[model samples]
Target chain A: MYKLSISDKAFNVLNYGFLSFVLALTFYPLIYVLSASISDPAAVSSGNMWLWPVDITFEGYRKVFENNAIWTGYRNTIFYTVLGTLLHLCILLPCAWALSRKELMAKKAILWVILFTMLFNGGLIPTYLVIKSLGMLNTVWAIVVPNVVGAWAILVARAFFQQNVPDQLVEAAKIDGASDFHIFFKMVIPLSAPIIAVMALFHAVGLWNQYFNALIYLTDQDMYPLQIILREILILQEVGGDSAAGAVGQTENLLEQAKTAELIKYAVIIVSALPLLIVYPFLQRFFVKGVLIGSVKE
Target chain B: MELSRVQVPSTVRRETRFHKIKKRFLKSWQLYVFLLPALLYFIIYHYVPMYGVQIAFKDYFVTQGVWGSPWVGFDHFLRFFDSYYFWRLLINTLLINLYQLALFPLPIILALSINELRLGVFKKWSQTITYAPHFISVVVVVGMIVAFLDPQNGLINNIIVAVGGEPIDFLTSPVWFKHIFVWSGVWQQLGWGAIIYLAALAGVNPELHEAAKVDGATRLQRIWHVNIPAILPTIIVLLILNMGNFMAIGFEKVLLMQNSLNLSSSSVIQTFVYKSGLLEGQYSFAAAIGLFDSMINIILLVTMNQLAKKTSDNSLW
Candidate 1:
C-alpha cells in the first residue's frame, strides 16, 4: 500500500542503520557482563570471554548462595519493598483522591505545600536527623518511612484521579445518598486500577534497588539491603586477587571470589529486577496509556 | 445567582454554631479523613525535617539534639563559600548537570527516528535491545564500563590494539572522566527516556499527516509541520523539569565510578555531602552545603517555571 521514493528509501535505510548501531551500543555491555559472569575465571582473566562464555559454570552462583549475608540481604530487601509499597499506596491514593476534588477546602494551600517540597527539600542530613530523631535508625522503618510517598508519584496519581474520576459520577453517587468515601472506594478505585498498578511497579522497583538509605541509616551489616551487600561483595571480589583485597576478605580462592562476585552481581540484578520485569510486559500496554492519561492533562 | 447570594448571607448569619460545625464536618469529613495519612506523612517526614533545616545555621551536635544545638548563624555557610573546593564542586556539578541537560533530548530524537522506521521486526528488535540496558542497576552499569575500559585487558583496549591504535585509560584520565560519565549515562538512559517521547509521538494525529501528504508535503516537511509541533509541549515541559534539577547528579553512579585519579573531576556536591555528613558526621557543614545546593535548585526551578509560563504557557505551576 505504501511506496517510497529513492530519497525516502535512503532515509529509511540510514535511520535503520543508526537505530541498530545505537541498539548494539546499548546492549553490548550487558552481553559482556552476562558472558563474563558465566565464563571460567581463568578465561575471563585472560580476556578470552566476549559475547559468550568461555567455560560455563554454576560454581559462581553456588558461591553467592553459600554466603549467609546474601540471603539476609535478600530477605531484608524483600521485606522493605513489600512494606514500602503498601505504605506508599496507603498514603498516595487517598491524598490523590482528596486533591482531585475541587471543592475541598484549603485545597490550594495543601497543593502549594506539597509542591513546595517537590522543588525544595532539606537534603540528606536533615532528613537523616529527622529519621534518627523518630528512632528509626538501624531499623527497617528507617528505609521505609521517609520515602514512602514521592511527590512525583503523588502528582501522577492526582492527575490520574482528576482525569479518570468524573465529577458527574461523584455527583450522581451523592444524589443517590452514597457517602463520598463510599463513592471513592466503590467507584473511583475500581476505575483507577491501571494507574495504581503503574505506581506500585514504579515504587516497588525503586525500593528494591534502593541502597543509599540503607547505607546511611543502618550501621549494622546484618541490616544491609541486597544492593549494599552486593556492592561490598563486588568491591571485595574485584580486588580479591591482589594484596589489597586481603584487607576486605580472607577468602582462599581470589579467582573464585571474583567469579562469584561477578555472577552474584548479575544474580542480584536478576532477582531484584526480575519481578518488576516480569510484571512490566503485562503492564507495558497499560503504561503508555496510563502515563498519557495521567500526564497529558497536566 | 441573586437568590443564592441573598441566601448565602442569611444562611451564614442564621446558622447556629453546632449546626455550622456539623455542616462543615459533613461537607469535608471524607476529604479530611482521606487526606489524613498523607498529611501525617508530610508533617512527620517532610515538615518535621524542614524544621531541622535550622541546623544549617548552627553547630549541630547530635548529643544536644536539634533545638539545643548552639547557633552559629551563617558560619557554616561562610565556610562553604570560603572553602577552596567550593568553586570546583559548584562548577563541576553545574557543568556535569548542564551537559546532561544539553544531551538529554538525544533519546527523544532517537525515539522519533526509530518510530519513523518502516521495518517492522527491525524496529521491534531495536526497541527491545535499547530498553534492556535501562533496567540494569547503576552499579552494574558502572562495572560494565570499568571492565570495558580497563587498560590491561578491557574490550575497548583490545579493539584499539586490533585496529593499530594505542590503548587509552578512559576511566582514570581526568580528561576522559566527564565524557565517559555523560556518554555512559546517555547510553543507559536514552531508550528509557525515549519512552515518554514515543508515547507523545503515538498521540500524534495520523489524519494531519494524511492531509499534509495530500497537500504534496514530503515526509520531512510533514514531520516538521505536524509531528514536531505536536510533541513540542511535552518536549518543553520535560525540558523545564530537567532544567529544574540542573545540579542534582546521581551520587551512586558517580561514587561507583570515582577512583583516586578521577576524584578531582568526579567529586560533585552529592559525593562531598555523603562523605562529610554520612561518613565523617560533620552534619552541620554538610547540611549547609546541601541547603545551598537545594537553594540553587529551587531558584532554577522557579526561574525555569516562570520562563516556561511566560514563553509557552506550559509550566509545572
Candidate 2:
C-alpha cells in the first residue's frame, strides 16, 4: 500500500486546483458566446448575457442562415476544403511514397529541394504574382491549386511511410515481379489508411479555416469564404458605430443592420466553428498520434 | 584494418558503384513516374514563384515580361531601407517573435502540472479544453477579443465596474494590444504546444521515478530531475523549430486584430506587405520588403540553431 506524504499531497492539490482553474477559464468564454448567440441582441449588446441566455431568441441564427452571401460562402468553403484536400493527397501521398523509398534516385537531392522551399519561400507578393500570371486569381483553382503542396504534410506522410510501411513488403512485391508503382499504389496506400485519414483531416481543417488567400486573390464578394465575409460584417459593425444603432429609416436601415449584424457575429462564429468542433473529439485520437509523429522528426 | 578493406581494385570500385546506382535506377524508374506530378507542382508553384522574386530588383510592368523589364539594381531595396515605416515594421515584427520565444516554456509548465496528477477528470478536461481553442478561426478569436474587451459593455468592463475600478478599452489601446495578442496566443496554443513535451514526458521510464522514491527524493525533485531532463531535447528542438518562423507572426491574426487605432503596434511586416502590395498595388516595393523579411528570418534561425547546438550539443542536423 502506498501513501502520499504531506508534500506530495500539497503538490497534488495545487496541480488539481490549477488544472480546474484553467479548464473553467478556457471554457467559460466559449459558453458565454454560445449563450449570447441565442439571447436577444439588446441583451447581448447591454452585456447582460453572461453565463447563460437572457431573453432567449433565435433571431441572430435566423438572419445568418437567411443571408444569401453567407450561404454562398459556406458552399465555397466546403468545395474548397473537399477539393483542396483531394488535390493535397494526390500530390502529397505519392511524393511521400516515392521519397520514403531507399532505392529512389536523387532522393537526397529531391528532399533537399523540398526542405529548402520549406524554410524559404519567395514571400507573399512574388507568390501572388506567380498565381496571378497563371490566370488563377478569382477562380476556384486559386483557392485549391496553388495550395497543393504543404511541406510539413508531405514530411509527416513520408515519415509515416518510412516508419510503418516495411521495406520487407516492398522487397516481397519486387521479387514477385511487381513494379515499384504497383507496390506503392496497391500495398502502401492501403496499409497507410490511418495516416491518410489524418492527413486529409488536417488539410481539410486548414482549408476550411482559410481566408487570407481569398482576401488577396479573390476580388468578388460572391467568391468570399465564410471567414472573410464574417470579418467584413465585423468590420462594418465597428465602422458603423453607435449611429448604426440609433439611426432608423424607411429602408432596412443602419439600426436594423447593426442589431442583425451583432447577433449574426455570434451566430456565424458558432456556425463556422461547429462542424470542426463536432468532428474534433473523434479525430482527437488520430491527431495526437499524427502530431507526435510529426514533432519527433523535428 | 588494411586486411578488412576487401582488397578491391580502385578501377573496379568505380564500376561497381556505377553498376549499383544503375541497377537501382533501372529497378525504380516507376517510382520516378510517381514523383512527376509532385515535381511539376513544386516547379510550377514554388520554384516559379522563386524565379519571380527577381522582380524586386526590376521596374516591373505587365507590358514587359520578366526578362524584358529594365533592371534598377537595388532601387526597391534601397527605397524600402529608407522608408519611414521600415524601423516600425522591423521592431514590431521582432517584439512579437521575442514575446513568443519568451513564452515558449509555458506550455511545458502546463504539461508538467498535468503530468503531476496521478489520474483524474481534471486531467482529461484540462487537456480537452485547452486544446479546443486552437481550432477556432482567427476572425472569431479577434471578434471574441473585441466583444470581451468592449469598454462600455464587455464582460471584463462589467467586472471592473462591479469592483469599482475603471474600464479599459484593451483592444483599441496601443499599450494593451501586444499583451492581448500574446496572451491570447498562449491561451490558444498552450495545449497544442504541450503535446510534444507531454509525449516526451510519457516516454520517461517509470522505474526512474520509483528509484527516486526509494532514494527519498520529493515530488518536485523527481519532476525536476527526471521529467525536465527527459523533455529537454524536445523543448530545444521545438524552440529551434519555432525560431525558424521567427519572422512569421501569423499575419492572419494580426491582420484581423489590427484597427485604425492600433495600427502603430499591430502593423507587422506581413501586414505591411499586404497593405502596400495587395491593397495599394506597389508590387515591387512589397516584394523587396518581403524579401528582406525572409532574409532576417533565415539569419535568426541559423544563429539560434548555432547557439542551441553550442549550449545543448543537440541540433536538427
Candidate 3:
C-alpha cells in the first residue's frame, strides 16, 4: 500500500470520527427504547433512565403479552403477511416472467396496462369504494388481494429474468417438448431463486408493516393488524392524553395507567419492530441486491 | 397442385395472416395464461377504481352508484379551490416536499464519507447500525418521535431540563412540525437512501482512483474529482424519482403525528381527502381534491423528467 501523508492520516481520523458520530446518532434511540422498556416505569418517567436500564423489570413485557389485542394483532399480522406475501409472489412472479418474454404476444399492451397504475390511480376514495362494492371490506381478501402486484416489482423481476435467464434454455426446453408450465415451474422457478427470494422478502416485509390499508378497510377489532393496534396504544394515547384513561377503563387509577402506558409504549415498539430488526443483518445482502436490481433501468 | 401455387395474392396473404396469429398463440398461449391473474387484479383493483374516479364530477351516493349519480361537473373542485384552506394545504404540501428535496444531497454526502473509510469492523458496524432504522415501521418511528418529544420526562426534554432549559412542545407547534417531520424522515432514510449511492460507488472503476493517487492528489481531492463525478448519473436518476413523488409526503406518518393542534401544517391533501371522503362521507368533494393532487403530481413528474432530459442525459422515462 502507498504510504499516507500526515494530512491523509488526519483525513482518515476525521472520517472515522464522523462515521462513529453517525453510528451513535442512529443507534442511540433504538438502544434507549430497548433500555427504557425494561427499566422500572417510575425510573423511566422520572428521567432517571437514559442510556441503560435502571432497576430493570419485566412488567412492560408482561403487560404487552397479556393484552389480548396485542396477541390478536400479532396473529392477524402473521396470517396477513404469510397469505399476502404468498399471493403477492404467486401473482407477481408468473406475470413478470411472462412479460419478460420477447415472444409473448401483446406484451407491450399488457406491460403498459400495468405501468399506467404507477403514474395515475383512482386515488383513495374510489379504491375504498371498489373494495366496499366488492363486499371485501373488513375481510382477509381486502388485505391480501388489492395490493398483491406492484409495477415496480414486476419491472424488477422482469429485468432479472431478462438478464439472468438465458433465452436458449427456454428454446432448448421447447425443443425437448417440455411445456411452458413445465419450464416455468421446473426450470425458471429454480433458476430464479435469488430474484424470488428478494421479491418475497420485500413483499413479506411490506405486508408485515402494513398500516394504512388495515386502518382504512377494517373496523373490526378482531381483524385489526398489529399496526392498527399499535396505533391505538402508542398514538391514540397521545391524542387523548391522560383523560383517555377513564374512557378505556383498562385501569382505574389515572397515575398507574399513565405509568403503564409509558412502559408499554417502548415495549410495544420493540415487539413490533424487533423481529424485522433482528432478522435484517442476516438478510442485508438480499435487501441490497433488491435495491440494486430495482435501480437498474427497465 | 400447380393451380394452387398460382392462387390470388390477396387470398394467400389473408390465409397467412390468420395462420400466423394462430401459430403464435399456439407457441405462447401459456405465457398469456400466466399473465391473466395479474391482469385481472389490475383491472379490478386499479382500472376499476380509475373508472370510479368519475365520482369527482358527480354527486355520488351509495344508493345511486357511480353510473347513476347525477353529473355535476367540477363543482366539488370549485369548492375546494374556493375554500379557506386551499392555499394553506397547497403550501404545506409543497413546503414539506421542498424541505425533503433540499435534503436529497445528504445521503450522497454520507455515502461519500462511508466510501472513504478503510474496510474494517468499524465501517461494517456503522453501516449495519445506520441501516437498521430503515427497517423500523413508520408507526413505531412516529411513536418513538412522540415519546422522545413528549414535553414531560421525554428524553429530549430531559436533556433540555438537565441543561437548565424549558421543555418545548415539538409536535404541537406549527413552527416545529415541518422540521420534526423532515428531520425524522432524514434520520430514518439517510443510510437506506445511501445504499444505492454506495452501490454506484462500488461500480466505479478503481483505476481512476489509483491514477488520482499517483498524480499526488489528497484523499478529499480524489473523492471530489473521482467519486462525485462517478456517481453523478445515479444522483440524477434518484432526483428524478424524488420529483415523481413530490406530492406524496408519507401520509401515514403525517396522519400519525398530526393532532388538531398541528392541523394547520399537517392537513395535507391526502389527509384532507381521508377526512372528507371517508370520515365525513363527502365522497365527491374528497375525490375532486384527490384528483387535483394526482394531476399536479403527474405534471410535476413530467416537467422534472423533461428538465432532466434537456439538462442531463438522465430522465425517468
Which numbered prediction scores highest in DockQ against the true structure?
3
Residues A91-162 of candidate 2 have per-residue lDDT tens digits of 899989999888777777778777778778888888898888888899988988876777777789998998
The two-chain DockQ for each candidate, comma-separated, is: 0.45, 0.50, 0.56
Instruction: Give per-residue CA lDDT, model 3, range A1-298, as digits (tens).
Output: 7688999999989988888888889999999999999999778877899899999998899888777778889999999999999999899989999998988876777788889999999999999999998899999999999788899999999999999999999999999999989999999999999999999999998889879999889988789899888887777763122333556544455455556667799998999999999999999999989999999986
Error of 2 at A126 (Å): 0.7
DockQ of candidate 1?
0.45
Candidate 1 CAPRI level: acceptable
Query: For model 1, how does the per-residue alpha-carbon lDDT over A1-298 read when each residue is reduced to its tens digit?
Result: 5677677677777877887788888777766666766667556655677689888976666655666777788888889999999989888999999989887866777777777778778788988888877788999889988778866777788887887788998999988999878988899889998888888877777788777788788988778887787666653344221233355444555665665565555444455555655665556656545545556544
* lDDT per residue as tens, model 3, B173-208: 988999999999988999999999998999899999
Q: Is the docking of candidate 3 incorrect, acceptable, medium or high quality?
A: medium
**lDDT values for all models:** 0.77, 0.82, 0.88
Ranking by lDDT: 3, 2, 1
Q: A70 in model 1: Cα distance from truth in Å?
A: 1.9
Query: Model 1 over residues B1-317: C-alpha lDDT tens digits?
Result: 00101111223454596587567768869888988898777767777777788899999987888888899999999998899999888888988898888897698788788779766887776766676566656755675676668686678887787788998999888889889899988987787777778888888988998898778777677767898899888888888878887778677788878878888898899889889998899999999999998888889988998999999978987
Alpha carbon lDDT at B16, candidate 1: 90
**TM-score of chain B in each prediction:** 0.89, 0.90, 0.94
Worst 10 residues of 3 chain B by lDDT: B1-10
Clashing pairs in 2: none
What is the Cα-based lDDT of residue B88 in candidate 2?
88
Residue pairs whose backbone atoms clash in candidate 3:
none
